[model samples]
Target: MASPADDKESTPLLFSPKGGGHLDPANNGVSDGPRRRAAPPPQPLETHYFASKFDPPQIAKVSTNSSKYRSENLATPIVKKIYSSYSIIKDAIQPMTKPSLADEKRQGKIYYEDTYNDLPWRCSCGTHHKDGIWLNHSDKAGLVMSSLVWLMIVYAGFTVTLLVNNNSLPSHVGVIYCTLCALALASHAKTALTDPGSIPKRAIPNEDNASDPTVKFCNLCETYKPPKSHHCRICDRCISGMDHHCPWMNNCIGTANLKHFFLFLIYVWTASAYALVIFGMNYFLCNSEECIFPTGLVALVRLMTFMCVGALIFTSNMLMSVFWGIMTGMGTIDRMKKQEDKTFDESEEEPMAFTDIFGIGSYFTWFLPIDPIFNDYDSVMGYSNAERLQRERSTLV
Candidate 1:
């Protein structure tokens, strides 16, 4: 027999059908010849195309950007004066604050640097307070708005009823309608008077308080603001757990007074509906009772006025309440959809929940103006009942 090395050298190499290359089994099936691959097809123009970042020749292009630059750099004395005048207009309109906001700021300044208790000095910064003059701040504005709504409600239901629909209804029903209307007004007034909730002014961060949670800075307020607080354009101060500003209430709806706000909405809506029924009865009596309508231009004017009141009230409050309900229902769903659309970092605040709207399971309390057991800021700040109890116990211990 031949030696193993000679035998291996003499062994015939296998041929591969791929372009007739000699396959080397010993070389793990690699080709002995220089490998050839099919030439790649040419790429389309799109593949080769690229946008050039270089600007066109300066003489060739007169860009809109240049005009923007020119306008921004306009700093003549006349322009400065014009800008100053515009700024005054802007200051007059932008971010209307609570009445005597300057005095409020002074109070906050006194307590802004709470040393021992890092918790919000809510009395100093919170919206709920009775110290100011009667019907000032949110109260004054709300009073005006509520007064308007009440006047409409009363005029539509009670006054119009007295004029036209009153005789049609029994005494007790009329009394009930009047009472409901009055209660709605009272609820609205209470909602206005109540403080929604305010964010405490934060302690100035320094060597000692740099790491404190309550040392947040508000760019708008030019001071430290607490967590879960934001500046209200209407209130012109930071509100704690603020939901939104209601022009109808002329106030910010926030943590402390949302209960009252919800109650006001419900009562007003009910009152509006009751008024609508009264108006409907007047129309029904006009058509059904075959009653002789009041004669003379003055009486005729009163009749027309009653009809208009009913129609207007129906449009403003009844339909408006329906629209409000739709809007309110959509709010949470929209927030959830937006949350789904966004990819937030770990640090961002969460989207407001349906539960945050004040009612899901507890309809009784939600329908009325009564406060829930967990409606306070402590609860709003994500404190679970168990966690709160545990923290309390720990503090005691």
Candidate 2:
């Protein structure tokens, strides 16, 4: 409602800190009645403070965090080097343990063992390896000696029998039986003494990664072996399931020819019995006249030798047979006990009869070839007589 010029003059400008502005009564302007003093300017405080994003002031915490981190990073290699140095010193100070008295004794005795094959001494694997059937060169020599002695006895008896009885066996027949039997017996004995048959580490399984403690205990051989298998330091071969090495046969007898050896024992026993019977009959039939028969001295000597030899052969055979039978029985019992100790229905069953340590009979059947009739060729040679015959027949055909 007022004029535009009056309206513009009545409006007041806002006050600012830079300079005072024109005022109107409507917006805190002075009246014409009395003059008023301006309010004193706000006084500055005695002290002032400020804070920044990079630096806080109130808490004067001088931080060593950066330096601490840097120091720790630098110390890593030093700490590691110090530890390594200390470890070396500690190792140098530790004394080596001396071998035990038992170990020393075992080492000393091996030198005088007489036989090439070591007796089943206690191995480091904690197994008592008493089952030694190793045959060494000495054994082979013994076999040859035994066969010679046996032949002498047989020949002497046969010659005496021809005089006593009108009817007599052919010379060739006696020779053939003696020769064949001697060879068979020698071979069988040798086999019994050697051939560990596959795995011979002390109680070591054939499975991959198998471990046994006794394997390292062979001081004489200086190698690890499974239980029942020993290293013949002389032979330098680990025999599988080694019973023992027999020097008389010059062979290591293991699981392979155990049966043949037993058969040889039986044969010796029978042969000895036959010799005893003939010698006894001849001794009684010769009349006690003229201070002794003309041929009586020789007969008497032959009879005495036959008696002595037969007794030795018979006794040895009996003892060996008993020993082997006992071993087999004990082995079977142990296997059964193991099976029983495990779960009632565990899949692991007792191994079959004649099963070697491998839980398989393949080694004996194929490798050793035990049957004299079936295995006509030499087991060592690995060829059957049938194969030879087949070849010959093929050529002929």
Candidate 3:
């Protein structure tokens, strides 16, 4: 029943390979399957490329914000290497400082030799000492003797005054008083004049650093002396309450002699007062006796001279006695008191030895062991006035 045209249209076409040719599905009006992607052209070989044309893929632009990059660049090993290298180089170039022995020897010898003969005493390092202050043991002894004499003179004068004022007073009383006073004066004088040279030597340790400021160890005397003791620089021995070296006495006033000095002060004061009183009484009592030196005008002049001199001596002696007594009492009290609040230089690492400051006991026996003040001769005695001036000059140079 179907026409030829309909039949032809409904029939499917099938292409067959003829003469070794492939079939074309699109030309036969049948849709072809998915087309295959075209193959890309072959890439050029990398080895044959120019070195400058490609920049090694630009190294992928890494960011330091990453912990991995930070650790790698800033390793502890590199930091430690820098530090050690600096220390080694610095140590290699550092200069060494050392002590100077030549300077020490020179200074020590100079100070020792110059000061040896002047124990307990010091020269006025200046011109003022052409006539020095004589405060030696002998002088102290003499002062004590003078004081005793003064006591006798005062008692004698007082007795005479009492006899004149009280008619009932016995004459024998005056004689007894005068005799006792004379004995006391003579005893003091004898004690004071004792030879200091024969006294035993005692070395004094450094008092400032000692356990007891009131007591010191003496190497020469081989004993500990009472407080306020100093070795006489002149005698090369220790003295108690030794104020200073006395060129006049040429000996140290040790504890053995200190009592005499005080007694002397007492006696001197008494004698001075007695002299004044006697002078005044005699002036009135013998006014009409021609006031004779040997007689008449000569005697009057002599009497006047005696009175004037006696009055002056009395006043001066009295003042000195009072002052000395007060000072000694105060000093004694001070010695009894314990010192608190000790201070020292923070900058100093070590203190000088006792012998070094006080000197060797053998040569500078004021202390127990004659010791140099310091082995460091350059710093010995500190900066003397001369040395200070020298330093000032060197600054300009």
Q: Largest lDDT belongs to which candidate?
A: 1
lDDT comparison, 1 vs 2, better candidate? 1
For residues 1-397, write the lDDT of model 3, one tens digit per residue. Answer: 7664322321112222122333345555323322212332233223222323322333545588988778878888788899999988878766332224346566663211223234364443211122133333434454564564455455455544454345423466455545545544543443334322222232223323235444445666555554445445445444444433323223333323333333443444454455455455556666654332233233433443464366457547545643443444322223233223333222432332433233333443331211223343223321122333344446556
lDDT of 1 at 157: 58
Segments in model 2 whose C-alpha atoms lie over 4 Å from true places:
1-204, 207-224, 233-236, 285-297, 300-304, 307-397
Q: Write one digit per residue (lDDT tens) for candidate 1, span 1-397.
A: 6664323321112221323334467764443331222332232222111333333244455565797656656657669899999999999987553334346566773212212222234333224332331122545665576567766666645553554452545567667767766666766665666666554343332333335665666776665554445677666666655656676666666665665666666665565566556556666556655333344333643654564555456446534543343344322223344469885232443444435545444766565554444533344532223233434446566
Best by TM-score: 1
Candidate 2 weakest ten by summed lDDT: 375-384
The lDDT of each candidate is 0.51, 0.44, 0.40
Model 2 residue 58 CA deviation (Å) reads 99
Global local distance difference test of model 3: 0.40
Clashing pairs counted in every model: 2, 48, 36
TM-score for all models, in order of appearance: 0.45, 0.37, 0.30
Off by over 4 Å in 1: 1-143, 160-166, 202-216, 220-228, 284-377, 381-397
Clashing pairs in 1: 97-235, 128-195
